[model samples]
Target: MTILLYDLVGRDTARPFSPHCWKAAMALAHKGLDISTVPTRFLEVPTVEGGVSKLVPVIRDGEKVVADSFAIALYLDEAYPERPTLFSGDGGKAMARFIERWSQLTIHPYVTTAAIMDLHAMQDEANAAYFRQNREQRFGKRLEEVMAARDAGLGAFRASLEPLRSTLAYQPFIGGQSPLFADYIVFGALQWARIASPFRLLDDSDVVAQWFERCLDLHDGLGRKVAAAAAAAA
Candidate 1:
């Protein structure tokens, strides 16, 4: 059966910009599962799954409803045990949880500031206002104010990527020979930036850059299918 994925989308429905959503999307692709994606906006999230879920990346497999990106990934892994594994083994599964947390707590903050403007510009008025209000409340400043110093945040962002860069310098993928769910966790964050903003998060020479490119080429150029919007153009 084709699973129903309520994916978070932007003004352009084709663009699914949520990092969490990307993790689930890529995980599904990795498992070679057939998915029917519904492009869902922020305001519409509450209506998903009969209003039981207030988040995107909610998936319905038959009568079973799963919410949260990570939960969905775990569900996919268990639901399709015969397919390719999202986590290689128990250790990888536990490690993936740590990596996911680090990406969310450490990396997302920097990305938020850098891509805030580009994200807002791409949104319609309602989404733009909703995003601005929530984000501003969290950051205690305006969206423009947060993104205005993106250049200033570049150093920190690059520094935040050091662990990934160092690791990729020696290995082809985070899981050594192949990308596991852990790899998708990190890739999703970068993909989030790519879809929402043109701000270059990695330097041209960084190994992380090369790793990210390899990730983009995965699953028949699925990542390349989305057009990246330039942050300056907004």
Candidate 2:
């Protein structure tokens, strides 16, 4: 079956900036599944797949429809066991849930907070206002106010990634010899920032940067091609 992935896109459709959407994309890639993507704008997502999901990364695999990146990851893993494993075992699966939560609660906030302005710039006027209003409500402050501490923001964000840095220093990926859903959980956020902003999250000498480069090379350079290709235009 040809899977259809409704991917969240900004003004530039080539830059699918939603970390959640990228997670689904990478999962589908890991499963060796061929997918056709529809570039969806923020305001357009509420009607995706006939309003079944008010989110992007919603996938339709033949007659089955799935929403939420993590749910879709599990679905791909189970449905195509012969392709390759997303999770190594039950323990790995459980570990992935923890990683997902950590990425959401910790890493995602820093990345989004730092790149709020960059994200705002990528949207058209209508979408930008919509984004500003919604995010301001969430942050209880204006976008400029939220991103005012960007200098300190980068330090804090990098510090939050210490555990991952320490781990990657010893192993090539969170999955040791191979990349796993846990790896993708964090990579998705990294890719999000990469696409939405010119801010460099990791230092050139950082071990995490090295690992990130490895991830950039995976699936025939799928992750790198998606966002970095749009960097010039952005």
Candidate 3:
């Protein structure tokens, strides 16, 4: 059965570098799994008839509809056990869960906020159109209200980054040498944020930046591909 991944075109989600979807995509790519990507815009209702709420990064493996990124990762793990293991052992499993949760609960908001602010700055017309359409589809409220909420959300996001900064300062990866789900989760969020906002989150931190580069190298040379493509386009 072919693995079908529902993704966003040009990374339109809250974070431009969606670590959640990236984690799933990276896992599949790392395993060299035969997969097809179906890019969709944010909040676009899925054509599949199911009970799932509207969300991007849904995976369809034959008749099965796997929603949510973490759930999709679990499904991939179960379906293809021969690939590099995500959870090495009980301790590793625990760390994986913690990292996933931390990325979602803490890192996601600030990164997303930064991205939105960046978009507004760089592409005001396109960003405003996107914001209007997305707010109407997802929030079903006036644009003003959505903007207000986004402001509050950004503040909350800044507060959330404090713990992550402290934690990352100590360890090279979330686990140490080898990166597990934690490293990927954090990387994904930060990657998306950097792509969208071009922020300096890792600029001053040598260890974290090096670790991030190492992770990219391990995962099929994504950074290389990006650089090559940019150079070619230039």
Model 2 deviation from native, Cα RMSD in Å: 1.9
Q: How does model 1 fare in lDDT?
A: 0.87
Clashing pairs in 2: none
Higher-TM-score candidate of 1 and 2: 1
TM-score of each: 0.96, 0.95, 0.71
Candidate 3's TM-score reads: 0.71
Off-target runs (Cα >4 Å) in candidate 2 are 227-234
lDDT of each: 0.87, 0.87, 0.61
Query: How far out, in Å, is residue 199 in model 3?
Result: 2.6
* Candidate 3 residue lDDT tens string, 7-74: 55444333233456677776666556777777555434355335364666777888888877767767
What range of 10 consecutive residues in model 1 has the weakest lDDT sum? Answer: 225-234
**For residues 41-90, could you state the per-residue lDDT of candidate 2 as single tens digits?**
88998888789886778999999999999999999988898988999999
- Which ranking of candidates, highest TM-score first? 1, 2, 3
For model 2, give the 10-residue run with minimal summed lDDT: 225-234
Count steric clashes of candidate 2.
Answer: 0
lDDT of 2: 0.87
